[model samples]
Target chain A: MISAKLKERLIFIGPLIVLPGLIVAWPVLEVLWLSFRNRVQIFHIDRWVGAANYLYLFGEDLRFASAVSNTLYFTFVSVGLEFLLGLGFALYLRFSPEREWVKGMMLIPWVIPSVVSARLWQWMLHAEAGIVNYLLQSVGLTDAPIPWLSSPDLALHAAIFADVWKTTPLMVLLLYAGLLGIPENLLRAARVDRTPPFRMLFCILIPQLRPAIATAVVLRLLDAFRVFDVIYVMTGGGPANSTETLSLYAYRTYFQSLQFGYGSSVVVVQVMILAGLTAVAYRLLQGKNPAAAGDGPGEFHPRRTEVKE
Target chain B: MVPVKRKPIFRVETMARILIRSLAVLAILAGCARSGPLPDENKTVHYYQFSLPRDREAFDRLRTWFHEEHPEVNLQIHTLPTSSDDQHQFYLTHLGSRSLSRIDVFALDVIWLAEFARAGFLMPLDDLFPEREWEEFFPAPVQAATYDRHRYAAPLFVDAGVLYSRKDLLLKHGFAHPPKTWEELVKASRVILEREEDPSLNGFVWQGKQYEGLVCNLIEFLPSRNPFLTVAESPRLEVDRVRRALGFMRDLVVRFGVSPPSVFSMSEEESRQVFQNGRAVFMRNWPYAWRLAQQEGSPVKDRVWLSPLPAFAGDASGGKGALGGFLLGIHPESPAREEARAWVRFLASPRAQRVLWQDLGLTPARRTVFPDLPSRGIPLDVLRQVMESAVPRPASPLYIPISQSVQAYGSGALAGVYPIDRAIRHIESDMGRIMRVMH
Candidate 1:
């Protein structure tokens, strides 16, 4: 009794569903399986260690704990700063009358490559003859030159500063898009109701932009957690291992130490952390969905008449 | 909307299809221009060279020299960080890979050939160069290059650690000449410190950074002590003499106060700059600084003096300095292995050696290059003295770990974190574990 067109539609969608399963899901599952294997020498699955690698990481490797802590510290701090800055920029751009050239000019930092940006920052941060120290000294801010990359305490902060410089523009653009998509009538209504600026932002704008913020936060958090290139170029985790991130640790384990088995375990550890964070974010977003729905009026009826008008 | 125009649109579509087909054919033909199968005989040579920032010009010259000799071969050169340990990491990555294209020729440290040869990274050079050609080279350097009765690399250059002093400072200290013994050196440093008006000025400066230099400085003084680096007929380390050596370094920093407190962070270049700026009275550095100090516009252009590292308690054995230099090793993966060998042989020839020495201020590997040349600004007798006393670092695959342990443990004492004895004990135990694992 099925129509030919309907049957063809079902047939067309069947392959699409299976294609994603075959491409992405299947490979991710394979990585999960391989991570449990004892060794990956020559890509052979020699034995099953059954969580022993994970156990050894938490139990014996002190560097694992330090790297994990450092990664988390970077993720939260840098993402938080970038979020505030991006939100502020998005608000400013949304309210202000935009000049065409100004909009184009704001995209420069985001457009440049991360490696090139990092190298530029590195030159500025050099201890002896760098511009940063030169300016600081000229202003009489401090009597001595600060060792930005040379000191353990300052190295991580320096790396974070570089990461913020390169990535904040991305956050701003995403938030700006979310802001533009917000209905202008809702904001106008809030102002008419005598709602203050802060209250309007918290009650109307933020609830509406929850989906966008969640998406942007997850993306930026993932990037900050796995920040490798800038840190690798800046410090290489020296001055007594103060700036060691999880990715750099994994790299050293695999490349420098040549312990592929252990290195894979480190990678698995990072993957688990990222996956857990994503899951938590998903649940939080889902939990807030009900609140977002509550802000809207009853929506069972379609506004066909209003649309026609 | 316009039926008459539809005919023209259909005709244009047909013409566009024809043009697209023609363009595709042209693109394929252009790609095919260079897509023919590579010949079986052609081989690519991948050479990895590690050098300092100052040697970029010399490296370019060497590149041109290599290119002319092998016109048919493809050549790749990888410039690495100036740090030798970091360069070793680059080698580790390639050797760990199962691929042959990773690298073809590795310019190795003289001491590294032993460990690398044992690890199967280096190909035996007997097939490329005859024994007589190698015999003409210095025995000690050749010995340093050999492991397990097989020659792994040919000596490329010789770097001798020497005492660099300010000639003006020595004269100001009531001594017209540089010190030759530990006692004399310390006395001169005290005199200079007493007379120098600036509080920031240092009497002595050397590499105390947590690196191979600390171990080298410690080893030079090991032979003068009662114990030695190794036990007879055993691989186990001699702990007591090693402690004495560590103790001596600590005294140099703390008890003597001749060296700067910031010595813990000073590398070769930093210490050199400190001395070259006329800030320090004496310095310990390799011969490369001789050229830099003599270069135009140097602050200490005419004020620098060079001599052997002062002996401890006037003992020759205690003053034994470690020989450091680069060596050339053929990569097992080199496609133009025979051609690469010919070029390497040319590089080692007396003609090339002499040219490198006279023109570039580079220390040549061959003994003949030394006796025939009386290069201006470098005293010939000083060269002979360094060659006679050159000692090689300990050859072991465990050297990497040993060097790290030495750096980590002794760095505490260098930074005034722990006492010398405590640091020595830590180093001994660390070395023990490393040796056990490596063996």
Candidate 2:
């Protein structure tokens, strides 16, 4: 007969062994393993050259640098604008008389598929026969039509505009949830005490909504970091690679260049950066408590003591 | 009891039993997956053919014929999109995976054999074609199929960018014939565009899209001096000659304004629609447009005429017109390779060509088919001349990227995003970089 201790250990380790195996852990490990190798061909795989792929990406390849810069630029600008607009909409909706119907209609942009939106935007912005150009020219704003997607300078900005339209609704919903729980009595008390509109909001409202704002920012930030499909189908990282992002760069290396090893390296770098940012965000959201480290109040003050007494 | 209490001590016997059973299961799975080279009667040959809207019926009829002729050999045909670049991407992805199965016959561009063959995706057909039968094919068509002294593909169908015109419009202008040179064609097109009642109506509708179709329409002027970059021995372009040729084409849209901004959005169907509705005085397209123009309710019905694209002026020698055609290849992974070979041979034969020509209105690859059959309404001399004169694009692996870059630069210039000289220099620089990597 097996010992009880051994049986317990076996049961404990069984899930630990199989859980990660089934959840794409093995494939990820394989990519990490291959990332170290150089010049993998159809049948033969070359041996390890530590950090060569990493060096190539960071040092030699201007494309990768451009992609990183563009990705960061897009993420911050778009998310920043989205947050401001979303917060404003949420505030307006909080005070507005027609709250339910107005809020329901506001979700329309968020519900539409991104690909469909991109295609619609492409048609509206076509240089020759597009509606935007026709209107622009008709009103005597400009003599000629603007090459919105064709201009390298404006391609990324145009893509950002399309993305912001789609994602702003998400921000609105998050901020709206935060706004709903702002303790209306405290706000009334402050207003009765002659706390001006700006002062009352800054002092009483925003502090209570900190947790919700943090959550929304984290969600938007993470999503913005991995932007691919919209920019891909729209500009294809073209007009002289002005709008190239890390995801597109990785894809080109993997598919177009057929350099899986180098592509894996790029993916690993992105994962690490995202993971680091997420960890920091999570810490900030949980209030960064030192006393709570390996100890919640429940750990210190047990309910069993009351039972014993 | 004490002995029994002592654990099995990591016994090899039990461990061996578990290992053996697992191995047995794995072996069974492996065996099941292999299927051991399909049974002779069940072995099927699959071919990758491009899917164009116009060829759906023809492909179906061809499949039915192949099945009847070789009942034992099951033939599966897969259709890809008409865009050559898209189709090339599919092939590239599959080939990179080293999974050559599911394709017995690979339909490729006439210019892609050299690169594909070198890449080991194509099977050479040196011993497949007999010496005497090779002579029957038009020289240009045969030359297109041959790369580096090896036959990797067979020219299946021949297409040329013929000028499809409105015969009634020409007659009204007191010109019963199509223009013979670039200058004459320009004058005729100008007159039609200027006099047309509708402002939206165009005099010429040629492909100016940022894709392979651009090369098909624009490269006709390349033969003003020598279109092919390399001669028999050399491997470098006569750069100045090519530039001059490209200049003539650029001037057509930019300088003349004969074509429209809408041309940038057009493909084969778009161009065909423009001419078929009498909105265009002339359209440059493949032979399939002939059948479409004759269909009922077509505005240019019974008033359509086809001729080779006009040559450049001041040229005693012929102008360079692009040779457009498809090539059939056999996949190395095909189970029924032998039967697929027979099918390809039969399809390439004059008998099949005649049937394709008569039923599908497709031009045959063989020169003799045009003269040998009375039912082929095309004049024998004209067919021979087009066959002899057609200049196939450079058959390199880099052809797709190079051609795409060509379209990108040319379209950019036509759209007024860049000047002609700047665009040409950009193209030359970009192509030079790609070529260095290729070499």
In candidate 1, residue A282 scores what lDDT?
A: 62
Clashing pairs in 1: B224-B318
- TM-score to native of every candidate shown: 0.75, 0.72
lDDT of 2 by residue, B1-439 (tens): 0112446777899899999999999999999997876645436767787875556677677778877887777776788887676786688767656554456777787877766776777788877788777777767667777777888878787876677777888888877798878788889888877776667577788776655777776667664635535523324444676566556665776678777656654668868877887778888887677767887787787897777778877777665457877778876656677888988887887877877777766578877677676544444465556667777777665565456556656666665656656666666654553353332
lDDT of 1 by residue, B1-439 (tens): 1112324546878899999999999999999986978634436666677755456566567667766865666556677777776787767666648464467677888757766776677888875667777877766677778776777788877776788889987886679888888778878898788878777588888876656787777666673633334522334556677777677666777888888755655668878888888878989888888888888989999898888887777574645456888888886656678766766676787877776676566678788777788576877678657766677776665555556556656665655556767666765654553343232
Candidate 2 lDDT for residue B422: 65
Q: How does model 2 fare in lDDT?
A: 0.72
Q: Looking at model 2 chain B, report the run of 10 residues with the lowest lDDT sum.
A: B228-237
Provide interface RMSD per model, one decimal.
10.7, 13.6
Two-chain complex of model 2, DockQ on C-alpha atoms against the true structure? 0.08
Give the alpha carbon lDDT tens digit for every residue of A22-70 in model 1: 9988876765665565542322225665775666678745457768987
